[model samples]
Target: MAGPSVLLPLRSSPFRRYLLGQLVSVPCSWAQVVALAWVVVELAPAAMGWVVALQFLPSLLLGPWFGAIADRYDRRWLLMAAEAGLGLTALAYAAVSLTGGLTLPVVCLLSALWGVINALDTPARRALVPMLVPPAQAPGAAALSGTVMLIGMTAGSGLGALMVTQVGVTATFTLNAASFLADVALLATIRVGPSPRLARAPRQIRDGFRYLWHTPRLRTPLLALSVVATFAFTFQVSVPIFMRASFDGGASLIGTAFTVSMAGSLVGTLVAAARGLPGRHTVARANLVMATAMIVTAAAPTVLVALISLTVAGVAWSFLLMSVIALLQTAEPAMMGRVMSLFALVLLGGTALGGPIASALAAAAGVRAPFALGALAAAVAVAIAWPGAVRPADRSSRHVTTADAG
Candidate 1:
């Protein structure tokens, strides 16, 4: 059967089912993230920095291993497990909160579990996109997914804040738990396309390291992106502190800032969706825009200025992230699951480390210092990735020499 049109993957078979599942799933996931962050802020005002840092610790620690599993297993079942885990994790958080025994330590421990589950879920869910849509429609499918996620994030963050304010954290946590349950039910019935047989798999775990190391197309972009992500994601953590200290804002205000930025991301995703075909210079252009926006963000003194800068940053964030995924898809479809798993590791793992370090620097230097440093890193990463972007060569061109291997 012919695949759905590039513009409307949502109008067809298996992809339509998956898209429906995602519509429900994305908002739930985003809601949980916002709620979890707010819960940490409430439980440990003294160590809000630490709580934020711990939230991403699992992605850093378990992402590579999960990637290895993604390469070696059926993605559908893996996603199901991940969805189920998220639901149960939500329940665990609810139990702690409902019992009126919620503590920072317990929340941290639970967040760690959520992190591991997230690490597994992210790559499989992302890499599975191509399976649902045709190769020609991959870019469109990606943009569709991005738009849904951004909208969901915007809605989820905004609603979570309101839920927390109007009702209680208990209600928010219960609702988050329900979202995961809903996602699980949606995923159970969709028909996933072909995945590589792993029964007699190559030592893909070890080869994955080798594959990444030897591939200039993959390694160069990945490493460069990691550098940029470390800085950009640091900004993600820094926003809360900046809002509280610089603007004297509270949780609701912080949520508003995130919601606004997410709006920008939504716009950017739509633009990308309209483009349809993946462009060669997408990453380079996105990075340049990102760097410019970050510089503006660092210098902005007023809340309005910061919000505008953040909106720009959000746009660049969406484009560059979608571009990065496009690059991965262009490289090797068979290896996508594995590569994406590792991609999640670096992206999120870097965020975990970046958050704590950025917070510490902000503490030692000033709130604006992290943004300054982040902008500089983004600039450099863009510069490094520039040459490769122009060449548009194969990622696997580089080879390991005996001397280097030794």
Candidate 2:
């Protein structure tokens, strides 16, 4: 249902290039992800959670500092440097695997290294959007960005599985390594106004935290996200565990259900994109829908019903995420980098924690327990935030800037 207005952001040449480049880069990245997951699951299923945790731990530990860097430096250069690092890492992975040097410990180390580069890259990439387009189109741009990930999910998952099976892991890693060069090229062509170069202050990161803590419009949505995102958004780790435990990792069934969920995410993104930005109450509704889907996934007696529920969950989760991004964009442009970095912080931090939490809960209870716990946490958080969520979003600017407190 994305109409002409929804496509307005595409008219920006810089955004167009960025979107197109990501179209190529994202799927490749996804292919590597699937290949990597396959390696972990096959080699040491017991270590999957630790591997996942290592892969995202940098985001939790180093995210705010990198976000400060994003606020202070040219995002384009930072992104390019990250891509270069990614390419090197991918080649290293391919070399190690092809030479039969791949192991659980090596994988953990490599995952951690990648996480460091990603922690730096994520905030910069996220904060770059408003620079590419006008503020009003931020919602549409946000929607488009979501599409990039879904597209990756759609193409990347299938491709990843296929390549891992057919072409072998080294080829898959090499393929993704090549994509980074293309990304770097595209990023070089992008034109933008100067990035904010904040002065070297000791507490720049703390200022970001303080700004987020005080801004009700900013704080409430993230508060809801802290719960929902920590639980619902960790599908990558949970679903895999679910498949391995419940269905014994039936490849066809997992693929079918995962693809269905991606389709649902596609639907969710379109609906949210069409609506522009939803109010806070709407976000609460999305939470309930997602919680319901997770419950259904937990309780369904048959695979058919479980698959259907995942699709629905995907729809609701994607819908809620659009609002999260759009709401975050409401922050002042000067503060946009830090705000988006916090968004990444909460998001990736949840991801870092989600894997271990899912593994522990699933081990103690049943495989389905993580989904149920996620549902309960999300519902409770949304309820607590509901009162404030009903308030209309404040449109007035806070005049917050990175100019050393004026």
Candidate 3:
């Protein structure tokens, strides 16, 4: 058989359908994010940070449990139900906006609810990717997924800005709600068989942790990722504030900045896809690049310079994200759901913890403070990861035990 090509995963009917659904749904999610940030900034500028934190709070609390559920249940049904629930939540937000009853508190409530749905969906969706393609194609599939998401985000942010400025927030929310429904429809067509059943085990969630503990190679990189996630991913909280406070720009400019960033992300994803999955040393190097980019972004004197810096940051960020995920998937195939959940927990939980700090820093020092903090955190992650990256492959390979084998 021929080795997997970049487009090989798309040839699978189930994966193709899932990709189509994501192409629509991810853009809507991005649009909603842009709209929600704008809405909070307009209604209660003081609560913007808190509102952003709320979106990730559920992931910190429920990620592990939900990941266990993904391992135990039918992922397709879980994903479908989550998509439906997301649609309802979007509709509720739209109704509130259209009725002139939208408030910061309401927005926060809805965002938390949305976060809960995501906590369930994310692990299941990730776990299903391997099931949809041949093992050799998994890396290509992951890259394709990342590329599609970035494309959606790029278009979605721009569309969201135009909708908010011209058609208003109500329209933006309504359109997002529709997109979820569309995703649900597409999901219904994917004809994958049920996942293999695992034997019921005591302390299933703890088992995932134990597995990680026994595997030093995986543990080191994941810990490094946790640090980076805490500091670097707080951009969602900082970007809007920076645009409004520092640059004196509005939604359109915010959307344009996001577009540029995602364009860079697309480039990074394509590079990783073409070259195949990166190893630990490459991921460590990507962290340093990300740190440099963040520092440059923080120091940018003009909006133009900031955008260029953000683009570089975006590229580095995408490379790091894809590399980490590919590493996790490659390391543990059987416990993928639980492992990925742990990954999600570290990343989202870090955001939950860091969002408020970033917001407070932005409130006090300036909007650019978080980027400086992110640079420091990234440097720390690089230091922690470097030794692991240089460790002998023979020793690292031996760490994969029978327990981790499928």
Candidate 3 Cα deviation (angstroms), residue 139: 1.3
For candidate 2, the lDDT comes to 0.80
* Residue pairs in collision within model 1: 217-395
Candidate 3 lDDT score at position 212: 69
Per-residue lDDT of 215 in model 3: 69
The lDDT values for all models are: 0.73, 0.80, 0.82
CA deviation > 4 Å runs, candidate 2: 250-252, 390-406
Candidate 2's displacement at residue 275, Å, is: 0.7
| Preferred candidate (TM-score higher): 1 or 2 | 2
Per-residue lDDT of model 1, residues 7-32, tens digit only: 56675477777677777766666666
- How high a TM-score does candidate 3 get? 0.94
> What is the descending lDDT order?
3, 2, 1
Indicate the residue-level lDDT of 265 in model 3. 83
Model 1 deviation from the true structure expressed as Cα RMSD, one decimal place: 3.8
